[model samples]
Target: MSRTAWRWSRRPSAPSSPRSRPFRSKPGTWRRCSGANAVMSCRSPAGRRRHRPPEEATMQPEPITCRLIVEAVAEFYGLSIVDLLSHRRPQRVTRARQVAMWAAKRLTTRSLTDIGRFVGGRDHATVSHAVRVVDELRERDADFRQQTDDVVLAVEATARTLARFHANGPEDVDPVAVARRILATPRGVPIVSIPEITALASAVSAQELTDSSKMMTGPMKRFRSEPRDRESEFDLYRAVAEVLEADRALKQAQWTHGERGAQARLDRGLKALRETFERETEHVD
Candidate 1:
């Protein structure tokens, strides 16, 4: 009715609107907002697709190890691994052992000497003879060839299975259980010597374990007196000293930094054990 009232009324009637409601995603849709400006992404649970990495079909299989080949051959011939490695000259065991050596030669990159050492405490000559024997038998005897083929096939299948297991996240596999199964040494076997060795190691004094140089004096003297005949004895003594030294290092590491620190020294000891024994000096004298 008045000038001020007419001016307010004439000015665009406050843009007639309904009350504002809070922002919401559509029914069955999930929403997530991020960033300063609140950018949002929405997806319906029913229509959502999960993304996954593509399967590695072209992944190469794990390499076949000598241990795997030996175990496979042993199992194929219905013989225990220990029997295969033993010096027994029974027909079945000899054949199985020979076949295992041959398979190890074919499947792994280990030297013949290494194969011999692993199969038994044998030398390279023994392994060479075994390989030749297996080759000759396989070539002349069809039945033998067939049997060897079957053993190789079993080994390959085992390798594939292992590869698949590792590729699929082998977190479920217990390493200790696997080792126990593979190293199932029977009662009264030479494995009993392990306890004897442990006892001997325990009998070593703290001074001897710490200062291996002191332990080496007697062995070195014998080695210097008879470099040829006493060589093996001296070597054995050196090995004991090395073991004691390793034990000292491990104990020290455990005391200073715990198991994690000691693990490195333990690995070094194991590596030393796996290596071929050699004298630092050919003739101590």
Candidate 2:
């Protein structure tokens, strides 16, 4: 045997002192093992503990109401007003309740506490759980996520419509301009028909490019069309589009060229476009 084996044979079978005891792990708690590599190992794999999620934080309420979120969700899901307010556990109602909780958190400035209370008196923890569940479902279910997004959009659109009507006045407002303005805002909802508004905006450029030859003025093309102001609906809308495009382009050119001689041309174009727009609107009115 080698010197090391002889020394091991001569040593005591076990240490007598308390200081020489081997380490052990305890239940429900972590304890590091009693060995280390030559490298610097501050924490062993055994010593690392499982992490717990952080607690929910409180928040102040926002201007948007909890009722608005709840009603919108309930309506989209075809559930009764009492469905969210009551303790019923029909799968559909439960889904709606959870979605409403999630949306209330998103749309309203309401705290988790208030969100829970409004959505069937759930507590903050429950509300948090529901929010997580809905998020997971949205990840797994594309259709469910789409429906939820659509409902949220319509509710926001309704809110915008009300706010716009109140702020911009009820009469003589250009619906297309208001729609474009709203669409320009970040996270803004479309108060009116988004498609129609977009179509009108696109037609502005298209009509400007079109020539007088495409006017559809021939009897075959104008058949049965009750024309007003000697121009059909298509002619009138196209004229309006041309005018709007001219005005928009002039402003762009002015911004690009500033007070250079190019601005004189833009100013003249704007004057003509405004006159044309006014004439067309007057004919329609």
List the global CA lDDT of all models.
Answer: 0.60, 0.58
For candidate 1, the per-residue lDDT at 194 reads 41
- The residue-by-residue lDDT of candidate 1 on 4-123, one tens digit each, is 998998777554444555566775444332221132223233335433223325546668766677668877877654456556566998889899889889877889977776665568
Residue ranges of candidate 1 with Cα displaced over 4 Å = 1-56, 167-285
Q: State each candidate's clash count.
A: 0, 1
Report model 2's TM-score to 2 decimal places.
Answer: 0.36
Over 55-138, each residue of candidate 2 has an lDDT whose tens digit, in order, gives: 212222224556667767777887644445555456887888888888878877778987775555568998999899999999
* RMSD of candidates 1 onward, in order: 19.3, 18.8
Error of model 2, residue 274, in angstroms: 74
Worst 10 residues of 2 by lDDT: 52-61
Q: What would the TM-score be for candidate 1 when compared with the true structure? A: 0.41
Give the 10-residue window scoring lowest on summed lDDT in candidate 1: 168-177
